[model samples]
Target: MLLELLLASVLGFIIYRFVYGDKEETLPLDDGWWGPGSRPSGREDESIRPFKVETSDEEIKDLHQRIDRIRLTPPLEDSRFHYGFNSNYLKKVLSYWRNEFDWKKQVEILNSYPHFKTKIEGLDIHFIHVKPPQLSSGRTPKPLLMVHGWPGSFFEFYKIIPLLTNPKSHGLSDEHVFEIICPSIPGYSFSEAPSKKGFNSVSTARIFYKLMQRLGFQEFYIQGGDWGALICTNIAQLVPSHVKGLHLNMALVLGNRYTLTLPLGQRVAALLGYTERDIELLFPFKEKVFYSLMRESGYMHIQSTKPDTVGCALNDSPVGLAAYILEKFSTWTNSEFRDLEDGGLERKFSLQDLLTNIMLYWTTGCIVSSQRYYKENMGQGFMNQKHDRMKVYVPTGFAAFPCEIMHMPEKWVRTKYPKLLSYSYMARGGHFAAFEEPELLARDIQKFVGLVEQQ
Candidate 1:
């Protein structure tokens, strides 16, 4: 009995150290953000065409055909054995993707929403621009730009677009309608992969700021999660003049401040899950986020240092692609299914939906490019310093997800965003909030934007 207790204590101490010991290392910058001109070139021009939209039947049909072909030949089921996955027994995921995965159906579904493309800073940016159905009735929709993170695309917003753009469709007030524009981050999918080395988060932020200006939106609201949150915060700092407000999932630099100031009890609570009061105060769900981070985020550590080494394999092998990307679908969603083959894709996302996202990476040959984002950004420690927070004057709202890799309590977040307005503890959802819990995320965005618009 005493030995067992000693083992438990040692295990707990190790986890606590692993979680809290690493303060972000400050790396020397090669080239700082806006070393010359802080302000991005160009202003909103009334005559500039916002975007070129081509929803022709023939083009849409070809996309559907491609989706059909992908469904016919499903991904290899060798992720466990090849990738050294802990579990030996794999789920019947292949049968589900082949038999049940409806790609043509999903393409038509995605095409139902309007799509647009525009050039900004020598890159072609793809986005979905959904306007409220009642715009002709003289109610102007608030323009909201939603950005997706790594391993995600503009498709993440498909579920939440209607809920935000046409609130009445969701049985919500028409007064809360929004004009949502979700963009694929550069190098992710449809958006052009940057051909240079210095295209980090700050650069993406600046280019996106230009995209917004080209769209004729003088003022706009911003929303994002993961890498999206990092870019959005940079936008808030870079173009405070144009961005009216900012909302984010997975707060960044804010975590740094918590390590610097919060009380010891709160710090311990943040690091190790101990106090019921802290649990009640922070996350409502009793999910084990730390284990998933350790297991799933091994890729992040690799990508940070030697992205090219692993990225080359993914770039070459289709089976390698499935193992690298699809594995996250299992562990990141929750702790209970950490070893499951399907990774609980069916629980929150349809087979077709999940496969489509994977296919986007596959078809674009962007798996390598996307992983390179980590090398360019983290390898340089941009997030640790260059992208550090300034005094953000714009209104801000934050939705704290229950199963996110990290938690940033309101008190901790205030260290960076001193003017924070809304902080809500999300009842449920993981890191991929837009894709997994779109309705809830959409509603929260509308509620927060409604408050910002009113102000």
Candidate 2:
């Protein structure tokens, strides 16, 4: 008993030191040139140019031809989405896409927002800038940058833009009107893909910081999920002074000693600082955390290790790409959807919106580039990156969506973001918070902003 007690005390002390002993450190603010060929000797053009989304008849024809030629294997009997995207339901989706879906109309919708491209670090970064349609006298809209993640584009923010930029029209308060900037992570959509290697989240964050600076913003708020969450987190770590506040719908705070205590059971977890909600979301540990990750993370393993090989196959076949990407939307949004025939895709999203997102990847021929991001960011392994070890100092807000792929407790988030100011248990939503539940996410953002301003 004495020996066991001694070992426990030593282990506890080690964990305490590892989690709380380190002095705050900032990730090195590095620079990179992602474009093909050697870095240019001259200065990069800083002009922000207007851009529009356009589609040709040939593009439409090709898409239809590809859809018609797609030869999908029949799904196993009653498999639903458990084994993957149900081919039975995929046929229904393809019929609508080929017959009812209008690419031209979708293109126009994409162009509704003011799209712009600027050359940053030899790459043309694409983003949409939306300002408040109406603002009270002497009230300037806050500049907020909302980034998109893998298999998603800036299109994800369309629903939430109006709520943030013109709240009064949407039956919400205008106290926090925002001039929103939704940028495509380079190589995702319209943004030019990096021709060279070693372009990771930190590099993207630096380029975005420069973009914000060129836009004349001294300080701004940032928000994101998935890869966006990591990129935004890097921005905060790289330059906390320039980020007025940080907001995230998802966070990557696992892979630490704290997570190792889960097997100790709920009684001990509560003593380790996990709340009841955390316990509820995390218990049945074998099923929720362990098996869930094992089931859902097959794509991550593929993307991180051999993205290019699969990217080639996906980028070539539109049908293959849709299945690959849409499967994530279905599972990540609500894993339980896997039990449904249609994957419950339309429960919270429309075919038009979902297909529009897929079209961005298809039209831009950027699937390969987008998949490479996983390799660049995670190829080195988890918690191996310098930024992973550093805690964010800027005021941070986190919205814990109930159906998110993994539930992050406030205790876990606080370890990485020591200045966390707002932590809300969102009523309803999943991975795609803005796309799935815009009002809920917008309200959380406003609440977090209010807290930051109060501080």
Q: Judging by lDDT against the true structure, name the best candidate.
A: 2
State how far residue 330 of model 1 sits from its true place (Å).
2.6
**CA error at residue 111 for candidate 2, angstroms:** 0.6
Measured with C-alpha atoms, the lDDT of residue 35 in candidate 2 is: 89
Which predicted model would earn the best TM-score? 2
How far in Å is the alpha carbon of 338 misplaced in model 1? 0.6
Candidate 1 similarity to native, TM-score: 0.77
List clash counts for every candidate, in order.
1, 0
Cα lDDT tens digits, model 2, 1-455, are 22242345345545545775757767888778888899979888999999999999999999999999999899999999999999999998999999999999999889999999999988999999998886668889999999999989999999999999998889987778899999899999999999999899999999888889989999999999999999999999999899999999999876445676776788999898788888888887777777777788899889899999998999999999999989989988998999999999999889989999999999999999999999999898655677766778999999999888878998878878889999999888899999999999999999999888887
Q: What is the lDDT of residue 5 in candidate 1?
A: 29
| Worst-scoring 10-residue span by lDDT in model 2 | 1-10
**lDDT against the true structure, each candidate:** 0.66, 0.89
lDDT of 2 at 38: 90
lDDT of 2: 0.89
